[model samples]
Target: MGEKVLSVIPARKGSKGIPRKNVREFGDRPLVGHAIETCRESELIDTVAVTTDSQEIAQIGRRFDADVVIDRPKQLAADEVPLAPVIEHAFAEVDGEFDYVLCHQPTVPLIRPVSVDSGIRAGIQQTADSVVFVVDSTHHYWKQTDDGFEAVSSDRENRQLMEPIYGEIGVFLSHRDLVTRGKRIGGSIEFHTVDHWEGIDIDTYADWQTAESHRSRKQLVYRVTGNDQNGTGHIYRGITLADHLFEHDIVFAVEPNDNIAIDMLEGSNYDYQVFDDNASFVNFIEETSPFVVVNDILDTTADYVTALRAAGSRVVNFEDLGDGTEHADAVINALYEHSNPPENHYYGFKYFCLRGEFRYATQKSEISSVDRIMISFGGIDENNLTARTLQALAELDDQLYVDVVLGLGYADPEQLDPIVEALPDNLQVEINQQVQSMAQRMEQADLLITSNGRTLYEAGSLNLPVLSIAQNAREQKHPYAFVSRGVLSLGQAAYVSEEMIRTAVTDYITDETRRETMRTALADHDIANGIERIKQIVFDETHENR
Candidate 1:
């Protein structure tokens, strides 16, 4: 059999930095329990022992299946006393004549069993007297000279070019003889680098909070409603913000719907719930008690926002045009322009939240010709604009390819299928539904026919000239789609005749200078950084009280 190895975990009862730090609850167990449990689970170590002065810590160590619990002497239990004597006492209590000994501190609960096994393997393979875990310093080291502070090394060089300085994280492995000599790391030391997060040794309240930030499963709850009438813009906006907050747990609380909104939620790896009534929604909110509640519905009422605020949630609303806008902590209305906005009201083109694909997208090479025409009304084109636009595109005798991009809510096949089947051979029209790469489709197209909503901004981001038609009066007020913004607003969908669309398309397509001007205006406006700005606002509001 190979030589025996002993693991000694030094956990004293009294702690100065954090009161009752050793026996205090951390996560689900006491601080010392993590160390004891880790040692007990190690395969390389033959025995696991803990040295503690407090009887409570000793009991916890035993309950965690520590092989031996040594009652440390009063002299070794002081706040200022070093851990050398504690490890020596634990080594002496063990009867085994081990070849190597590992000194682990209970304070560094993040130390894993795999690290212990690796350290032991290095000690045995290299035949080294000691092994210790260390982490590379992140900050530039400074030394205090007689005159003032000076750089320890490379004073003028960049931090990346400077030699790395390693800091010990209180985990050491040594030969049995070194333990008796009061030395955890002796001659022939082998250094083992640990993960930066794992090397964190919690000593203060801030340290514990940092550890919790990495370990805690905090969630961000999103509440939005969408369907054919409400449109899926809210659903898209909710998920976009949720994607930015991937560091935390994300949950979507949408109102009951069987539309493409459900498909969108199912596509993503996020938890979601379909609430039937306000009572159930309120109950769910009270139960989860999320870090933040994001409402992307058209307008949130004062009573609803008040109730959410009363539930101890920082409410963030999107496109909030109701009395609730005053009650909300933050509101982003990118499409709809609001005058005399409130303190947290973020409107205009600058606040437009595009998908990740279009944020940093480059404009098309040139507005060469109007050979390819694309039509994308919002996800749920409730106005049946696709069928109408197709009818107008067929009238054009030019051999133009029409790409009809359908959303999840485009379920009116009885009307759409006949339009496609009756289209002339010269006018090549292909229907693509639920397109994943809508940005690429927009980039390739010469003219874009879209509704006044989120897709209008997406088209603007790619510098694709838009022929916008309002789905309803609500969309008609969206100022960004007006002629002033280089978008040819074709009035409301119900009132827009096929001849009107043909006239607008012919006007933009025939005039190359007008198309160029539209593209130039769009290229000047950079809206990619809006998401970051909104994220900062959310972060500030959520963490301000904390």
Candidate 2:
């Protein structure tokens, strides 16, 4: 087993999303070229090679500078056959005693070179069976149910309470022995958490986006600097992008922090770790041998994402900045970033947030009684307004089931006790700080009394009409304009007495006409499908560049 790492890009003819998507130009070269260039640019692996079941892909690989190309056997090339066997078949066919193996897919057009090389290094560092690239998920996830996808963990009581990694990308590296031992890393896995630029695993056309081109992998190194908290929403958004991949060493950090911001990543079933985000971040990119970094987080998070574009990294900034962004090997940021922020700053509702269907299911249909009005504030109530919301609910009809949802991170039990004691038997306090299914709870409810952030969006997406309140200024700012645009925003309910709470509750519940009015407004503004907008921006621009 020598230090001979072989970069493997498996190009098969069967792609449901893009036709001949593998060979299509990715940046300066074709799609498969990115993988080949990664090998040469890294200067770490022994040789850069392409394993193809197709002659077309081999030609494309060589045209892009592959050192060697192997013709794959039909059995190994056939679809539905697992990728591990195909990779093993390729190595055997290639017939070299290489120590490490890097396997990447052509569809991963947005994966950063830093992540590619880092993945190989992580696998080697762990000396484990294999290392795969992954993203962290902060929310609780579960298997699909008859109703729809469901949550099985406690992270969704409110979003800030969630912490965990969901593998989104599929970059992987393995030791030759690990692969030869009839083991495709069925156990003992390691992972690396990369920035959004290094992540963004594409499956559908929508998976590729242009609106976010400003921050494609290359420029992300600039944007993420000096911003550490999940406050900027990078770690949280990064998880959704990484969960599709296998496993890895997790996080690319020059100085790693095991802060509450990343605590959720530790709970998953993979061996993941962090890399320093400093100079070594560029070093890892060189190892992957990519000519450019794709900046995936430029627009949404930090502003310094382009700092890595300076030298060794040779970054390609893909800004979704409203005006077409600066140059790079590619412009994956489908939306152009103007030099200035917009007048509203919030942009339209499209930029607000993206949530999976799992965000709203509370799974409370099992409850036979409809008298209780379930109260769930959210995961991270940076403002402890749960008491205010509950107080408002308490003064209401006094005949409802008040299931107040609070996260472990928010509100103390002492703050909630007085309101809990005043409720009638009809209003039972079932603390769901640990319940996983918020959608089920929303579905089982008579009406929702929640904040206007993601909670309002999720409720609206699910058609659960809400009596919306803005718990804080940030939360408050979002709804009035939304309500002015025909969405409902309850003002000062958190500060209102129990009497005002009961009146609003009774008015919203008893009046079907008013409830339907709010319901119609939300359904019209359901931006839940923003994933499509993102997908179109990246992949469409990548393809269009060809």
lDDT of each residue in 1-546, candidate 2, tens digit only: 236787777887666676776766555667677767766777567777687877888888888888788887788766578878877866676656788777777656666676677777766777767877777656656878999987777445665756665675656777787667644565667877776545666566566553135234321222121132223233333443344222212332323653433454445332333456545655555455433343444442222334343454444333345222442333332121223443312233443334444443442222232365666666556555677666666545446666777754564657678777886565667766766666667677767676655565556655556666666654555533354323355565446455665677777667667666665665676456444443333222322111
Candidate 2 segments exceeding 4 Å error = 1-236, 244-258, 269-303, 306-346, 351-354, 359-372, 379-383, 479-487, 492-499, 538-546
Candidate 2 is scored at a TM of 0.49
Q: Considering every candidate listed, which one attains the maximal lDDT?
A: 1
Stretches of candidate 1 off by over 4 Å are: 1-218, 360-362, 541-546
Candidate lDDT (C-alpha), each = 0.80, 0.56
TM-score of each candidate structure, all chains considered together = 0.64, 0.49
Model 2 per-residue lDDT at 527: 52
lDDT of 2: 0.56
Q: In model 1, how large is the Cα lDDT of residue 256? A: 67
Question: Please, what are the lDDT tens digits per residue for candidate 1 over residues 1-546?
Answer: 396888888887678889889888889999888888888888898999988888998899889999998988999889788877778888889887888888888767776788878878987899889898888885677889999998777565676877788888878888878888987777898998887767878889998887666665456677777787676777777778778875577788877663556777888766788888667877777777776788877777898888787887778888878898888888878886766767787778777777887866667657868899998886668878988899887777778888888876677656677888888888887787767788888877998998988888888888888999999888898889873466888889889999999888888878999999888888877677677677766654432210
Clashes of 2: 110
lDDT of 1 at 534: 74
Model 1 TM-score on a 0 to 1 scale: 0.64
